[model samples]
Target: MIVSEGQLIQSGDPLLKVDFKNVKDNVPSIVTPIVFTSLIGREVTLEKSGFQRAGSNNMISIKK
Candidate 1:
């Protein structure tokens, strides 16, 4: 990894990279969601935080 004080970076600039083509016979990179989700379960529920209802007025922004 590269760290800079105030340097700017473009789109294709490389920070760090490694080659694993030969080692793929033993292990392979993960490229699927099904295999990944089966390893880890969901962590949260959307309703737990409760819904946001409009204020006094019908508009989303309330009047003072």
Candidate 2:
């Protein structure tokens, strides 16, 4: 994971890094949802600490 548990993450924070150069197109379709689900789960945890989705950039930010 790019960020550790309980780490303060801001908008555009790098969450994960995956190698797609050798990956097939079909693989991304299968993996995308799983990655998003994992991110949403993390967002749930952050929500408890006042984090929220920021606009349509698929980023999370601490609520003002």
Q: For all candidates, what are the clash counts? A: 0, 0
RMSD of each: 16.8, 8.9
User: What digit string (tens of lDDT, one per residue) describes model 2 on residues 1-64?
Assistant: 7998778887668888777665665364424432323343333322232333435443433322
Give the clashing residue pairs of candidate 2, or none. Answer: none
Clash pairs of candidate 1? none
> lDDT of model 1 at residue 28?
71
Off by over 4 Å in 2: 25-31, 34-64
Residue-level lDDT tens digits of model 1 in 1-64: 5636456775446644445465565567523221222224444323323343423222121122
> Which stretches of model 1 miss by more than 4 angstroms?
2-7, 30-64
Deviation from native of the Cα of residue 30 in model 2, angstroms: 5.3
lDDT of 2 at 11: 65
